[model samples]
Target: MKVFKVVCICTIYVLMIMGTRPTVSLFAHELGASINHIGLITSLFSIIPLLFAIPLGKKIDHLNSKITLLLGGYLGVLGIVLPGFFPNFLGLYLSQLIAGSAQTVLILSAQDYIGRISTKKNRNQYVSWFSFGVAVGTLAGPLFSGIIADLFSFQITFLILAGIGFISCIIIHLVPNEYPIKSKKSPIPTSKTKSTFVDLLKIPSLRLALLFSALILFAKDIYLTFFPLLGLQFGYSNSTIGLLLAINGIASVIIRFYLAPITNRFGTFNVFIGSMIISCVAYIALPFFPQIVIACIIAFILGIGLGIGQPLSISLTIDNAINGRVAEALGIRLTVNRLTQVITPAIFGILANLIGLIYIFLVSSTVIALGTGIAGHNKNNRKTDVMEDSRVKSI
Candidate 1:
């Protein structure tokens, strides 16, 4: 049953993200939007989710997981289908807002479910599978959308994607309920007493994790936002751009599937550090190469870095959460990531207009290198703490 739920959620994610890149810019262009307007459209999705993540996560903690999952799928279906009918800038913005809300609910619920079902001994392995599912969907989305857009039209492709979302809804409905361990004897907290975003911010490891996640996500945002534009600048077509992005996804999926075993052997911190270093190299090399084949190769390496880094960071964050606060911790991490997604692209877009797209990759690489340094510092501090604790016990 747990596997079934995971599969269903992954399918929904693939359909949604697959259509996002293809439809968003095309929808904006169809509505006669400028590059600034396109930026607004993209930013809305992340901004809405950033604002609502904590509240929605708190809500999930008190609700039935099954219902939350079902509602999320339905919301996704509604969000996807509406844009097909409206097909204007306003419609595009509204769709993004709704889709963002749906993503918040689905992600929080799914993470909470996975956290509850798995034990500490196997938690990292389960989470890796979850991440792999996400990677698979993300990889498949653009490829499928590109094929549909080429063979038919963007509108029809969106409609088909919406249909896939509805199927995911049905799958969620059929999934067996796997509720968290709630005490039936205790009263649920009221809104004022419920866990607030401020409450979650007090944990030091979570705080560091959120900061690191944001930086990493900001770098990724720059890549996703400008890669297509870079492709165009180098005389690549829409289909070729889609294929390159697909390569990125494929690399991510391949790496994530095997990430758990590697982390198990080397430790999470080691894998995190190594992956970030590799990613830094990939981003630095990206702008120096302009050929389509070389760019794809660089993207593949970047994807591997991303795949390893994200799940390792998430596992570390979850491990560091206060007891029974895993959902809240995940929510905070996602909030920070979404916030970066919103802010980084807007800032980079302006920079792109002024300095050119090449600088975006170079600047992003520098930011990631800084994050890697922070992660390394944190790892050292952790080792020092452990050593001091052991010495005190020996005495």
Candidate 2:
């Protein structure tokens, strides 16, 4: 029941975010903003998270997570509806700022909430279900956004997105508060906060997890921010673009259904590397295929490739975290992801302007390939470290 509730809240949260972000990109384009400008606007969504994810993760360790969730939900609703009223570049930027902060809080609280309630035996399954919620939201959010924006105006679409976020807020309010409020005392010593980050980063497996997460975000951010523009360049309509995005979501949902069993069978490292290779291929294919059917095929392939990696990373981080610091570890993970989210689009935007957008896929694929190499090295180092620790203990 708890896992079910967590899935419900996360699905709704992701639905609002995934739906609104693509619309933001398309809306900015409609308002005469260039691709470069759209990328900056998209990067703005990660600004708050980039700065505060770790601290907020630490904070959630002591507070009532449900309250934090409620705050984020309502704030998200406010952010989503901002552009509906303003409908300009300024409104779009402001919405990203507010909505981004809400995103940081909602995700941190949700992951922490689920982690605290789950045990080692079931953590993978719980995180997988939580991810499943994200997948479902991803599938539905863009489809709804595209259809609504096509049928009505962007402003009306924003209003509807805000309404869905509002519903998520209500469900969050009703989610049973399973986490007990910790004493006001900090879990980690104040002086050790900086060290805590460093300590977590020192773990080879955790480092690999963060890298895997960053690579995933690199693909996701590129696709979400640019695919609409790419589709437009190919003369695809908003509805068609949304349909493609939704198809990607469908692939993610499908893979997540089998994620745990697959991970258990192949091991996380193999699955991680394999899925990334799949994404790299999809990235290479995306710009070359302008046909609707081929594009849909690419989106699904990309979805399956990207979907399995995130939950696997989450479970790895939680599994390896120091006792009572799971949320902070997740915070560290989000910090890396948000940083990727923050930098990639803006840089890709500049690259797009200089080199042309068609080649951005080649650039993204190369980056992913490099990241995969580094993560694989870290995985080997993790094995070495584990063996050495065992040898020392045996001695």
RMSD of each: 3.4, 2.5
> What's the lDDT of the predicted structure labeled candidate 1?
0.74
Model 2 scores a TM of 0.94
Candidate 1 versus truth, CA RMSD in Å, comes to: 3.4
**How many residue pairs clash in all the candidates, one count each?**
1, 0
With candidate 2 superimposed using the best TM-score fit, by how many Å does residue 335's alpha carbon deviate from the native? 0.8
Error of 2 at 317 (Å): 1.3
Off by over 4 Å in 2: 180-195, 384-395
Which residue pairs collide in model 2, if any? Answer: none
Candidate 1 per-residue lDDT over residues 1-395, each given as its tens digit: 58647755765665575557555765565567655566667777788779878767666766777988877778877877777787666677788788777877787788778877888998887788887777777777777776777787767777788887777777777767876556222122335564556665766666777766776677666666677667667876666777877888889889976886887799766787777787888888988888888988998998898777777767777787655667767887888888987888677777777787788788888888887787778778978999999999999
Query: Scored by Cα lDDT, where does model 2 land?
Result: 0.88
Clashes of 2: 0
Q: What is the TM-score of each candidate against the true structure?
A: 0.90, 0.94
3 Cα displacement, candidate 1 (Å): 2.4
